[model samples]
Target: MVDEALRAARAVQSRLRDLPSRVVIYLILAACLFPEVGYPGVWRKLTGALVGLPVAAPTASALAQAR
Candidate 1:
């Protein structure tokens, strides 16, 4: 279902699929307020507190690539 929406919205990432575009968008939005925390930190806080992220927490490099 998510993939279908991604396809419809043209939001999907490249073929690597190491990270999904939607997740990156979510993190990017969240990062606006906590820019100092950085992507990995935001990821830690988000996964630990906010949404129970369905996908595995991406590495810092992967997160950067996703963005």
Candidate 2:
């Protein structure tokens, strides 16, 4: 029982680790697919923000390095 619980916890942790990357990929795809609609300008701003130039380097670097 303990081993099974541990395995489940690890599995959950692993999936959580992957969630951010998957979300970012989905967001990028959405930006490409529905530009000028849902969040066209927003995605551009987000991309720019992530690049670590215009919006200050540290925060962008942290977000970029995440997941």
Candidate 3:
């Protein structure tokens, strides 16, 4: 899935950002799945299972700015 995401990101970032487009894409998709929860909650649920992996722990404002 991660590989797919990387491949899907054909566009490049204009500048260095804390959260990559792939992560934002998945995060938005996850938010759709769990609409009842806010971004912070969605982020927690997204990262909860992947405790072994290194992921961005972004803030609400950051998410809004990214989107």
| Best model per lDDT | 3
Tens digits of per-residue lDDT for model 1, 1-67 = 6567778988776766645677777788888978999999988877885565465867899888777
Tell me how far candidate 2 lies from the true structure as C-alpha RMSD in angstroms.
10.5
Using all chains and alpha carbons, the TM-scores for the candidates as numbered come to: 0.65, 0.29, 0.68
Clashing residue pairs in all predictions, respectively, total 0, 0, 0
Candidate 2 worst ten-residue window by lDDT: 55-64
Q: Residue 46: error of model 2 in Å?
A: 16
lDDT of 3 at 25: 82
Tens-digit lDDT string for candidate 2 (1-67): 5335546556323454423444455455656776664443534555564665543223333434442
Candidate 3, residues 1-67, lDDT tens digits: the string is 7647556775546677778777788888999999899888988997898878877778898886776
Better of 1 and 2 by lDDT: 1
Cand. 2 Cα-lDDT: 0.47
Candidate 1 C-alpha error for residue 59, in Å = 1.2
Best by TM-score: 3
